[model samples]
Target chain A: MGWTGRILAGAKFLAPLAVLLVLWPILIRAFNVNPQIFPDITAVARAGLESIRDGSLFAHMGASLARVAVGTVLAILVAVPLGVLMGVSPGVSAFLTPLLRFFSVLAGIAWIPIATLWFGYGFGAITFVIFNAVFFIVAYNTLLGVSTIPMQVRNAAASLGAGRWTMLAEVLLPGALPNIVTGVRTGLGFAWRGLIAAEIIATNIGLGYMIFVARDFYRTEVIVFGMIVIGALWLLIDRLLLAPVERATIERWGMVRSA
Target chain B: MKSLAIRNLSKTYFDAYAGAHVDAVRDVSLEVPEGEFVSIVGPSGCGKTTILNMVAGFIAPSSGEILVGDHAVAGPGPDRGVVFQSFALFPWKTVLENVAFGPKMRGVGKPERERIAREFLSLAGLSHAAERYPNELSGGMQQRVGVARALANEPDVLLMDEPFASVDAQTRMTLQEELTRIWQERRSTVLFITHDVPEAVFLANRVVVLSKGRVLEEVDIPLPRPRRWDALVESDDFKALANQVLQLVRSA
Candidate 1:
């Protein structure tokens, strides 16, 4: 795009942020809120600078990221193919779908109690929480993707001389790609939230722990800074990474409906 | 031995709404000769697609026999290629991959299969879009990929179900002509199904009119080779044949 188009798009994105910044002071004054309840923007900025200078921010962020990576990757590697297997047979899919749905509904936050009980308030518990947060959702989505592929496409592939293996590789996987990617996006969102909650509750060295530890000392500035960091990190991950991947996959493999 | 034969073919649905017994296609018999282009024209809900599905071995007949070259079709095999109306190309697959699917499925080696795919891709006039994904192409182009994919198997018989129904008027005309040209060159036995009379008359050497899951009449098109749509439009023979086919369909 031309510079004008780029400028317009940038402005479109920043407009909301600008409004939030302007409204922050009004919100603070209108409620007569103490600094302990909600720190001013400058205090939060100073806290952010201090954390970055001390390397605490990077350390916490890195630890959280690693746990999420290990958990989600392991989940995907196991869940997708298993989901496809269940999806291929209607009887299998029908039987398993309800079970998976039951598990998926009880995913993420609900697992924290049992996970902490079993794994004992550390990386193990946190990782387990993240894993299930992603696992059940991803597997369910993958099953939906595989099973919902139009029967006509399967028949078309069969008539085109595609064998069982070829049909799986060519028709089933490609046809289900859009749904699979969508599932990954949604599952990751849940996993991110679960990671933070697990870190606060069970772990001692991640971003969530940093915020929770700050709360013990009434360090409102640090808490506000951490919240900003969390929001910014998620924005970056979703906008720069997952959203683009989802859009590209949809454009590539999805049925494009012309307007 | 015919290229394809169906004897006492029947399909019944036993749903509550359809009642205990509802025969979709009842005791239909037909024979498709080798290297002949045959079109089956039928009214809506006439079970033409059910018959095609049975022949394609996607569905089994309720009670009857379906034979291709002395072999009873137990299930879908590489011998019969089907071109569907929906142009059901794998969206993730490029035109090349879609066309090469048959050979790939048959365990043909990569280099050989790719070469074979490229050749047929050219024959279908889709050589330029070989690298493009299915969603990136137009409806007509996608249908050509479907045709190329079917042809890749080099099947003894090709079955097309309303292949031109989804495309626009201009593309549909072009595709129909292209299909006839490809059929002439390949000389594969083709059973083309459509509800359009002109399309049936223009493409097939023999047109079978079907209504209520049974054959109404069969009309022979003796039009000369290299048939152009514009020239065929001017011919009295084309008009008369189209009229007769249309009348049969309307009455049905």
Candidate 2:
């Protein structure tokens, strides 16, 4: 597509969001809603500016993003190689697939209580939650991706003089990339939610912490501002970072015809 | 001397769940002289692909032996290049990169491999599409790239498994002509597998008819060289040979 077409596509995505923003303030005024229950648009905006001016908003954002980054990177580094190793052997993959699935299901929020107890309610506990959220899903996806490569492609590579290393680098890795990337996207999503939950329960500095602390003082404006920041930050991360990576991998490696 | 020899090769699959022994290919033997074009024609489930896979060393024969020149076939290697029915082009790689893959694996230098890949891509009539990924091309184009990739390895033999089966009839015919032209220029020994009788008759100097995991007949085609698709298909000799092969296949 041309530049104009891409710009139009971006505009199309933001149009609904623009409409929602316009409706929010009107709804609050029309209902005469209590500020304690839900702050008005002006109050939330002022709280947002105040936090930004005091530099607390940046600190919270940095803390949250850093934890997600460290946890997710660590998880990917460990999971991908292990998954590929397991996937290369049918017997091993079959034995471990159910186990991986079971753990993935029990990942993320479910581990929050135990993580806090083990790590004593700080960075370790929160990072552990995020790590748990990303690890199994990425591993499972990598395993599935490697296993699903057609035997013909592998045979073609082998017949063309591919050694073990060449097979892994050229055939296995590229073939499995679409699945691995998709795994990362999904795992990151779970990690994002887990980060928020962990921050609320265990940490003292993050968006989730900021909102949770505000709730005790009935500072609905601050809570509302923090919620908006969380939503916008997640949208940016997904759209700017994770989504594009997923899309590029799928387009480059997936066999689906490009439209 | 034959470029490839298969001696009483066989394969059997044991179905553990059903407790039954199934023979896929049984006591099949064939030989192809150097630079010869041979097509194996068989009905579905007649073990034609099994034989091809064995030749490619993707699968081991349950009995007997296969030899390429003086060496016993032990496993897949660069000596034989295989073109699959599915094309098997790596989607992530560009057309040129896919062709270069073999030479790269063999530890050829970057510049030399790229030059080899470019030459083969042009030979396949795809130099214009060197940068395009596999999914971006049509089925026929992808198969052409597959041919180029196999040829790029400079293998002693080319093993093709219904390489044009997935393309439309028109594209398949074009691809066949292109393949014949390329083969004429390169003079590589080819072993093509297909169920299409007309295709087999058109392409091969000898057609080996197989059925129920056994060789039924070996028919020679005395069709003249530099065969043109329109003229050859119109000739009485081509039709007669095709009909004879079709009859053999149907009866088998």
Interface RMSD of each: 1.3, 0.9
> Which TM-score value belongs to model 2?
0.95
Give the Cα lDDT of each candidate.
Answer: 0.87, 0.91
Clashing pairs counted in every model: 0, 0
Q: Residue by residue across A1-259, what tens digits does model 1's lDDT show?
A: 4789878987999899999988997898888789988888778889999999999999999999999899989888888887889889889988899988888877597899999899998888988888897888888988998888888889988877778787788777777777778888888898988899889999889999999999999999998888888888988899889987888887777555431
Q: Candidate 1 — what's its lDDT?
A: 0.87
User: Which one wins on DockQ?
Assistant: 2
Candidate 2 lDDT tens digits, B203-226: 899999999999999999989878
The parts of candidate 1 lying over 4 Å away from their true place are A1-8, A15-35, A40-46, A102-107, A254-259
Candidate 2: tens digits of C-alpha lDDT, residues A5-40: 989999999999899889988999999899999998
Clashing pairs in 2: none
Q: DockQ each candidate and list the results.
A: 0.71, 0.78
Docking class of 2: medium
